[model samples]
Target: MLSLTRLNRVRSMDAVNDTMIVEAGDTLLQAREQARAEGRVFPLQIGSQGSCQIGGNPSTNAGGTTVVRYGNMRDLVLGVEVVLPDGDVWDGLRALRKDNTGYDLKHLFIGGEGTLGIVTAAVLKLFPKPRSVTTAFLGFRSPDSALAFFTLLRQRVGQDVAAFELISSTALDLVLAHLATARSPLSLRAPWYVLVELASSRTPEDLENDFHEVMQEGLEDGSILDAAVAAAEAHAMAFWRIREEISDAQTRAGGSVRCDISVPLSKIPAFIEEACASVLKIAPDSRMVIYGHVGDGNVHFNPLRPVFESAADYLQRTSTAITTSVDAIAMAMNGSISAEHGVGVAKRDELLHVKSRVELEMAWRLKQAFDPKNLMNPGKFLPRLECVEALKS
Candidate 1:
C-alpha cells in the first residue's frame, strides 16, 4: 500500500481543478475524497479503495463497479509523474485533458502495472457528483436469465444503468453463512441474482419510476422472477453489500480457483454454460460460483470444493487444467483472458499465448522505450526479455 494520507503536493490551477502531485503511496479513495472536498469528484471507484494506492490503480488500470459509466482508471487520469527504472523522475503531471504535444507518454505508465516505471504522482480528472440514485435486486433462475434481464434493462434504461452485478446462489450462501448479519432478500433461493444501480448528476430526475417500469417489463418478459427495489439510501447500501461482500465470503469459504474474464454480452450465457460443463467433467462435485458485472461482460468465475476431495488437493491439481479450459473458451469467443483485474504476474503467460504478434511487438517496444533496464515492478504484467528471446530461439 502506497502512502496517500496527504498528497505530497498539489498545484492548483483553478478552484475546482488542479494538478495533484502524489507519491506512489497515495490511496485512490483519499485522492477522490480530497478532490470531492473541493466540490469535484473523480469518476473512478474500485474495491479496496482505501488500501489500493493511486499508483497501484494506475499501474493496474483497474476498473470497478462503476466502470459501466466511468470506465477504467486510464480514462480518469490527466497526467502522471514517474521515476524511470534507472532512477530518473519523469514529471509529466499536467491538468490539461489535451496537450497534443508529442507522444501521449502517460499511456505507457497508466496500465503498465509498474513494469516500465514507478508512478510517483498524477494529475487526475474530476466530475460533478450525482444527486439522486436508485438500486434494485432481481432474482433469476440461471446465468441465461440474469443475462437476458441485463439486456432488457440496458435497452430500456440505457446508460442510467450504472451497475448490473450477478450473484450466484452458492456465493450468496457463503455470505449468509459467514457474514453474521447477512440475509437473503427473497425467501426463495434462485440460481442467480442481479444487483443493479442507476445514478445521474442531476437530482429529482425520477429514476425510481423509470427503474420500476423497466423491472416490471423484465418480470413480465421472464427476464426476472422477482425484484426488490431500494426505497432509501440505507436500503440501497444494504443491497449493494451483498455484491461487495463476495470476495471476503469467498476467502472464508475455502481455497478457490478464480478467473476474471470477459466475453461479448450476448456470449455470456453460453460462456457460463460451457465453462461450467468443462469444470464438471474434471471435478464432478465441485461447487461453481460464477457471478460479476454482466453489463461489462466480466465474470468472477470461481470453482470451489468437491464433495469427495480435500480443498488443498483440488486447487493444487486443477490449477493448470482450469487455466487451459477457461482460456480456450475465452479465446474462441474473441474475448479477453483478463477483463479488468489485469495480468500482473498471475496471467502473464496466458496473455503471451493469446495476444497477437503485432500487439506483442508494439507493447515490448513501448516497454523498452519507457524503461530499458526494466527495474520498475519487475517480473509482472509483460513477459521478461529472456522469455521473448527463448520464444524466438
Candidate 2:
C-alpha cells in the first residue's frame, strides 16, 4: 500500500490570501491548529480531525457539523496537486479565489475518492476567526419543532448560526448509558434535541443578547420545550461531547445499520418519521439512534440491534434488510443515500441502485481517461462493468 503518512507537512501559510497549502498526510487537526496560529480558522471540524488526513477529506469530500455555515471539504479547497496515473504531476497548487480558467479541473479530484488520482497537497481556504462565539442546547417535543426553530434561527442570525445539530432521545439514551460523564444539557425530557452554536468575527460585541432573543421567542411561541445557553466554555464543550459521542455509544451498545443520507431541508421531519416507520416495519425492536446536521438535512439514521438479539442472527438476517429499507426511503425523498461518507467498497454496489446510467457512463469514462492502466487505488468507489451494464441497459 502506498502510504503518504510521512508527507505530513504544512507547506505554506498565506495569511494575506486567507489560504493554507497543506500536505496530503497532514491531519485535519494539524491544518486547523496551523491556521489558528495565524489567527484564522480552517473550518472543517470533523470528529476524526485528530487523525483524518487532509487529502482524504477532499478525496471523499468530507462534511462535518460545521457544513451548515462553512460547507464541506470541496467548498473549502481552492486547488490541489495530484499525482496522475502516468507518472505525471498535475501542479494545480494555486491559491486563487476567482480563477475562472478552463474547466476548473480541481473539482474532478475533490470528491473523486482517490479513484481519479492521489491528492498530494491542497490549497485550503481559511476564514476570519470568530471574535465571539456562543453555544446553546435546546429540547423539542418533535422533529418539526426542532426544524421550525432552525428556520427561525437562520432568519434571526443569518450566517452567524454556525451549527444546528439534531439528536434524538434514543441516541441520547445510548450516550448516557454508555458514557459515564454524559448528561442531558436540558432538564426537560424531550424526544428531540438540538445543539446550536453561533460565531462571527464581524460582530464586535458578544452574541449572547442576539442569540437569547431568538431562543426566548422560540420558547414563548411553543417551538422549543426548553433551552439552555452554556454558562461557560466547559459547559459548551460538555454539550458538544454528547453530540460527538453518538457513534461511539452506538458501537458500545452493539453496532448499528448505518444509513448516511441527506434530503432537502424542508423534507427532513417527514423523512425521519417515514424512515423510522420503514425501519420498524422490518426490525421492529431496532433502536433508532438518529441524529445529524439537520440544518443541512444530512441524517445518520442508524438502527441498532435489540439488546437481546444475537449479533450473528442480526448480521445475517436483519442488517441488509434494515439498510435497504432506510436507504430506499432516503432515495424516495430525492435525497442521497450516502452523505458525508463517499461510495467506498461498502456502498460501491449500492451506487448502481441509486445512480443513473448516464451518470455512471460519465464516471466510467473519466476513470478510463485518467487511469487506463488501472494503476491508482482501484476495486472501490464504483461497480464493475458487468454490474453497471445491467443498470446502463
Q: Which candidate tops lDDT?
A: 2
Model 1 clashing-pair count: 4
> Roughly what TM-score does model 1 have, to 2 decimal places?
0.92
**Candidate models: Cα lDDT each:** 0.78, 0.89
Question: Which stretch of 10 consecutive residues in model 1 shows the poorest summed lDDT?
Answer: 7-16
Clash pairs, candidate 2, are: none
Off by over 4 Å in 2: 202-206
What residue runs in model 1 are displaced by over 4 Å at the alpha carbon? 1-23, 202-205, 390-393
How well does model 2 score by local distance difference test? 0.89
Across residues 1-393, which tens digit of lDDT does each residue of candidate 1 receive? Answer: 334445444544344464455556667787777877877777676668888887777888988887877778888778888878777888887878779999999998888887887777877776666667888888888888777777766777688778888888888887888888887888666888989888765554577667787778878877678878777888888887888888887787776788888999889989989998998887777888877887888888988876577778988988678878987898799888888888888898776689765677778887788777765666778776566656654
Candidate 2 residue 98 Cα shift, in angstroms, is 1.0
- Report each candidate's C-alpha RMSD, comma-separated, in the order given: 2.4, 1.2
Question: What value of lDDT does candidate 1 attain over all alpha carbons?
Answer: 0.78
